[model samples]
Target: MNVLLLLLILSFASTIQCDIHTNRIEDTLSTEANDTNTLCKDHLQVPEKVRIDLYYESLCPYCKQFYVKELAPVVQKLMNYIELYTYPFGHAQMKKNDNKTTFECQHGPTECYGNGLHACAIQYLPKMSEYVPFNTCLMEKWSTDKDAEQCGQRLHLNAEPIRTCANSDEAINLVIYYAQETEKLKNMSYVPYTVINHKVMDPETDLIDSVCATFEKPPQECKK
Candidate 1:
């Protein structure tokens, strides 16, 4: 009877040990699962965007080429990783005579008008997504009130406000604001002056490569 009782006790002890082992395995698996979830959350966090500034004149052929051929083609891909700012005053002189402010553009009066149109568009369409396409259309075709209206209609944006702004003092002030921003760069001598992350980018360098270099964790578009 003692031997049988001893076997039964041993079996019971074994069952208890199995239960403990199972509980430990379940607890360990739960901890590992929680840790995995935490890791995934960290991995999925959004990263900061790189900043890009383009300082160019509206009538500059090089600016138009850059905007139409180079930047516009890949802008959508980079939008996920970049914050773009465009300054429409380049080599444009603002003079104050007897409290009257006058401006002169390198190209001509037409260039000044083009710059004003761009400034007004930027003022009305604060978002890059909205203004970039409009400006791209302007640069590709021409920078005129008619062109602005056509681009606005193509983009399904209201052109009246932008046209009114362009003809008013608001556009002039916006150009002045951009002039102030552009003057911040000392020894600036050319159109299509590009800055990435507050640093001047060499004109020879590929824009996409320069932009991709700024990211810590580049987006999928950068991989291409």
Candidate 2:
């Protein structure tokens, strides 16, 4: 009975840890939005840095696995050496009728809703750093409405603007645009499709190694 109780407690703790967000990227931003022109200010692009363009859907299991298991740590290690861009459009189809587009997501409506929120984050959030933590929140291990709300609040973002933009017609159009962008990817087959420096990569290979290989002057993290 004691052993069973201990296991239960451990599981509960693990769940809490997975769902919690502390020190989100927004908390560390040296800059904040105070001007309309800079509301979505992008980081300066260095010509010499490597680029990673990620295309994914909100509820793909494989995408989640690749993100949390592979891409997350690799990005951390290569943070200074790479530029990361993400599109939350995957195996989704859109049909236009009467000047409106209806979306058909691979994982259904809930996934579409999730994708909308993520897209809003990208569109609204000013810093690239902020997007990672926000997306990380969306990818919570114990995914729930409570978790989502907590994640947003943790990032010091008001929920109303994000929700409004997500449900708006504009967001749908942007998702469609992303879908078209994904379709343009060469050799595309699945969600979490990665394009490193504008080249589609095999999903089975180690993305970290691939990222390191592209560097003009590989950082110390690449040596490890």
Candidate 3:
């Protein structure tokens, strides 16, 4: 009897934990929007550092690796000097099939559950004051589970509304818009095309070096 009771308790705890994680991201994102004291102010006043807009697909491994391991941390450090934006390559298609209980990799959009959701996260900006935390939570939870709803709960978000928002046209359209605008910004035909202050650069070579040199003050400065 005790063992059965313990198992039930554990299952309940796990469910609760997932819900918390999912909602925490949204809550954090809301806070980020109002806390203007941070370095991510739009139309930045500073001039010395370059303005960067990154056009990327979440499915792209390079973008995932760069962002998870390198880019996000760099941005956090140089938040004052840089402006960042993200666009997913598969945003439009994802929305068309978002209500799906299971992903359709053969005919339907592939990123319906992946990068598509991240783009949806952008909608909370400037009003909810929780965009950053929500985004961070999403990124952190990436790959663990394909379902954003599950991930959102794990992030400690207000899971009730996020679940509703997850299935809405509003979320889908927002992601699509993010993709379309990103394509316009840099003519981005590739998954991880990076534009630094109007200068287009490659992530594997040029962008990586620039990000490192500018943010970390590399030991050997290239002439460029």
Best-performing candidate as measured by lDDT: 1
Q: Judging by lDDT, tell me the better candidate of 1 and 3.
A: 1
Model 1 pairs in collision: none
| Residues 130-185, model 2: lDDT tens digits | 76776777775433345556878898866566667787887787787787777786
lDDT of 1: 0.82
Clash count for each candidate, listed in order shown? 0, 0, 30
Worst 10 residues of 1 by lDDT: 37-46
On the 0 to 100 scale, the lDDT of residue 146 in model 3 is: 42
Off by over 4 Å in 3: 1-49, 90-110, 125-133, 136-156, 185-187, 206-208, 211-224
Off-target runs (Cα >4 Å) in candidate 1 are 1-44
- What is the lDDT of every predicted structure here? 0.82, 0.71, 0.52
Evaluated at residue 178, the lDDT of candidate 1 is 92
By TM-score, rank the candidates, best first: 1, 2, 3
TM-score of each: 0.79, 0.72, 0.55
Candidate 3: tens digits of C-alpha lDDT, residues 1-224:
99999999997886665445434433443444324323322323222244466666555556666566666665555554555666655223322345542333211354454554565565544322244445555555552234455655665555445445556766556665665575465355555677774677665675546754554333222232
